[model samples]
Structures are given as structure tokens and as C-alpha cells.
Target: MPVNPPPAPTLSGDLLTIHRLLQSPAQIQRRLRTIQDMRFIADQVLTQRYRSAGGAVLYEVSEPIFNTRPIEAVSPGSEYPKDVTAEGAAALAAVSKWGQATRLTDERIKRNARPGNELDRVLRKVVNTVIKHIDTITMSAVASAVTATQAAGDDWVASTATILRDIELAVADIEDLQMGYRPDTIVMSNTKYAYLASDEKIANLRQRETRDNPVYGGEVEVIGGLVVVKAPLSVLPSDDVWILDSMQLGGMADEAEVDPGYTVAEMAVQVQSERLARQDGWEVWGRRITVPVIQEPAAGIKITGTNPA
Candidate 1:
């Protein structure tokens, strides 16, 4: 019969070591799988929140270069004729003669003067709408890039590099147009500035052939917490990612702000990818890889020497 096995040795260290030694690699991998599942859930939550916040906004900035001439101020009128006595009768007669002469020629002078032309204020609003359209196109382009890159995995960085160049060129073309616009300003109220000029002569001039007419825009409406407007470029991308990209681009004033530096989402994606790549193809046992078993401490070995010092 085989000799009886020696009694188990006592563990001198903390109880934590026993807990760690007994853990299995499969158990650790299960935990890792749970974490990955949770990360995906978190990503979905973020995406939903981003969508509900708002939609794209059209932005435009313009400097109106308009021509204007000084307006002739009208003099205050008297309610009644001035009191006259016999001593000043001659002077009053002379003034009345002069006034009659001026009034007689007023009609002829007005007929000779070129039509009193007023500034074109409505034209400026139309021009602004056009400019905003161009900017909106740029915003849509950027948004397209964003959508293409969202959830792009390892290929996103490479794809966005190309998108960045294209976006720069497109935006540059928009700014290159010399939109020489001049709008007429009108006095809507006394001494207060108003952008829309509704002067009668100005309105008639706008109605003249080859002139743009006033556009009565309707009130802005919001549906489902998003401002909805008819845009030529909004239909290019149906995905939320692209829409988000466009919105971010609209917020930025220039290309310099488009750099994808250290966003939390980006960092999280990178960390997750790195971890997955590193863990791939490795057999996980409990939480550790399988290797040579560590021998336990030897016990119950009796001394066989003849004498002990």
C-alpha cells in the first residue's frame, strides 16, 4: 500500500492569498465580457441623449456694403401766419413774394429731380438667406464626415484624415465667393434703427423689374425638440452621426477647431480597442493563463541524520 500522505501545511500569510490562488481564469474572462457588454450599453445611451438634445442649425455671418445718401430733413411748420403791423407790412410783403416764387417752382423742381430712390433693405435679407444656405451646405458636408466615422472602429482615424482635407477645400470655396451685398436701411421708428426698410418708394423700387421682392418668412417651428427647416443639404445624410457632425461643424468658426484631440468618447474607444487586441487569441483560465503548478511547502520530513547539533 502507498505511504500515507503528509498532513496539509499551514498557510502563514493573509487569507487573501488563498482567495487569489483559487480564482479561475474563466471567471475573470466572464467579468471582462460583462464589462464589454456594459460599455456598449453606455455608448448607446450616449448616442440617444445626443440625438434628443437638438438638430442642425444654419449659421451665417455677413458684412453688408450698402450705398446711402443723406436724407433731406423736413422743417417744422407754423399753425398760423405771423402777426403783422403796418410798420412791418413792407417786409412781410417781400417774404410773401419770395414764398410764392418758391412754391410756384416746387412742382417743376420735383419733376426735374431723379425719382427719389430709397435703399434696398429686403434685398439684404434675401442675400443673407442665400449665404446661410451656402454655410449650411458646408455644415452638412462636415456632418457627413462625422457620420461616416462614427462607429468606424479602427478605420475611423484613417477615413477622417481624408475627410478633413475635403472639408477644408469645401469650406474655402464657400468663403471665396465675393458676395458683394448692399442693403437699404430704413427709419422704421423715430431715431431707432431697423433692418427692414418698408418705405413706400423703397417698396415700389423693389417691385421694379429685375429687383427682388420682400420675402415674408413664417414663424420658426420646432418638432420633437428639433428645429425643422427645409435645407438643400440636410437630406444628404439620414444617420444621426452625420447630423451630429454637421452640427459640430456649424458651431465652429473655422477649420482649426475641427481637431479631434482628447474627447472622452475617443479615449474610451481607444482604450477598449487596445484591451481587446491585447486580449485576443490568449487562452484565459479563471483570471490567469495556465502554467506550471506552484508546489506547496514540504512538510513532515523527519531528520535521518545520526545526531543533531
Candidate 2:
């Protein structure tokens, strides 16, 4: 059986819900996995391109294909030999060997010659080093997740933009969502006859076709809205940049309300600018990083329709 048609409002609303749902932890984890897989795929793509270049200068000047990072062992539970400590009976146990006991040459040899304090220092260093390595590994894991998160955010924005443009053409009507459609995608239309007095008809004659004119049959009221797109990028460590949030996707609303009677081409142009705004926003961010500035403002792009001729 074919899928049931979703009500018009449900189309945009459902997509928005899904987009918000993606920001949840479960979705975030899924995105992380996706990023790792894509990283591998991106590397493969670059490698293929490099090979296809066939001794071209393109591959030679390219920086490293990908950054290399060591995978460190991270374990909160590590077994340290309790008997290895140099104290009391444990110290005596450590001194014993299978070989013949050495003969005492001097009176000092018969006594306790090994300093307990010296042994404590060695044990402390060993514990400290293990703790340090554990911290290092934890940081690396977090950094990897951050990198993956940024990648996922960029992928989502770009992917969503592509899907929206493709799907926009297929959308028949959008306003039915907020007015007639309820929580369910069910569209309830009142086809019952209604008695309208002559006075009431004249009163509503002009009002009926405000923007959403001709309720019975008319040109679909397609409200134009601004399109939002985001891209992920990194600031050079030398720049000492800080992102309060690990990943950010920011753009204007999908449908920007305009004066209802504008030409469709004006709306289309606005949409196109919003699409380009994604690239512009990234460039603005890049420039902010390079220029010496005390603080960087949040970056975004706003697109508006031009007045119709």
C-alpha cells in the first residue's frame, strides 16, 4: 500500500520536530558514529582524488589528508600490586629472591639499609604517571567527540538544505497545517452547506480573499520564508578561539513572512540568498578569527524579499 499523504503543515512541522529531536543525546551519539564513518569516507574520497590526479600538482600542495591521533588506553579500573608497596611485611616480602641469600659484609647490611621514604617516592611517581596518562586519554576522547560533533552539525545543515530544495517543489500547500490540520495529519474540511445572508456575503467579499483568498478554490497561498543554513569550521589553535557550544547550526526561519502579494521570483531570490548566506556566515567567522578582536559576535545571515516591479 502507498503511504498516506501528510497534511501540508505536517510537512514542515514534522521536519522541524525531527530536526529538534536530532539534538537529543541519543541522536547526538548517532551523529557521532556517523561522523566517524564519514571521516573514513572523506579520507577515502580524498585519496581517490589524489590518485586520479595522476602526478598533478593538486595533490602535492595539499596538507595532510587527515590528522593522526594516538588511541590511548582508558580504564578507570587498573590493578596495582598491593604487595609491591614497601612497608612492613610487604617490604620484607619484596626483598626475598629465589637465589642464595647474600652474605652480610658489614653490620649495616644486616640492618635495614633500604630507605622507606625513597621507596615511597618511586611508588608515588608510578601512580602519578598512570593518573596522568588516564587524564590524557580522557581529554583525547572528549576532543575526538567534539571534532565529530562539529562534523555532524555541518553535515546536517548541508544535507537539510539539499533535501529542502528538492522537497519544496513537491509541496502543494502549506497553510493547511496551522489552520485546519490538528496534531494529527488529518485534514478536516467542512463540506456541509451553510446559510450566508446577502449582507454577510458582501461584508466578506473583500475580506475572504485577504492573502488566503478563495477558500473554496484559489491559488495556494504560498508564504515565503527565509532559508537558514549553517556550516562547521574550526579556528586555528594559534587563534585561541573558544566555542561555548561544541556545535552550532544557525540560520533564519525557513519561511519568512513577506507582504503577501509579492512576485514568486522575489521569494525565490530571497531563498537563494538565504542559501548563499550559509557560505557568507562561515566566511565572516573565518575573518573574525584572523582579525585581532576582543570578542566575536554570533554570526548569522538574514534574507528578505525585494519589492516587486
Residues 1-309 of candidate 1 have per-residue lDDT tens digits of 665796544433322232232233333223233332122211111121111112222222222222234335555783543332222111100000000000112122133322111101111222233334333443343333332222212121232222222223323332344233111110011111111132233334343453334345322222112222233223222212111211212222111111122111211211010112342211111100001110100100111111111
lDDT of 2 by residue, 1-309 (tens): 665785345344544443333224344233223222111111111111111111111111111222345445656786532332222111000111011111111122112233222222322333233323332332232233222111111111132222223222212122222222111111001110111111233224345445544444433222112211111122111111112111111111112222222111211111000112333210000000000111101111111111111
User: lDDT for every model?
Assistant: 0.22, 0.21
Q: Could you tell me which 10 consecutive residues in candidate 2 have the lowest summed lDDT?
A: 282-291
Model 2 ranges off by over 4 Å: 1-114, 148-309
CA RMSD for every model? 42.2, 35.1
Q: Which stretches of candidate 1 lie over 4 Å from their true place?
A: 1-118, 121-126, 129-133, 148-220, 232-250, 254-309
The clash numbers for all candidates, in the given order, read 8, 3
- lDDT score for residue 37 of model 2: 15
Model 2 lDDT on a 0 to 1 scale: 0.21
Q: Highest TM-score: give the candidate number.
A: 1
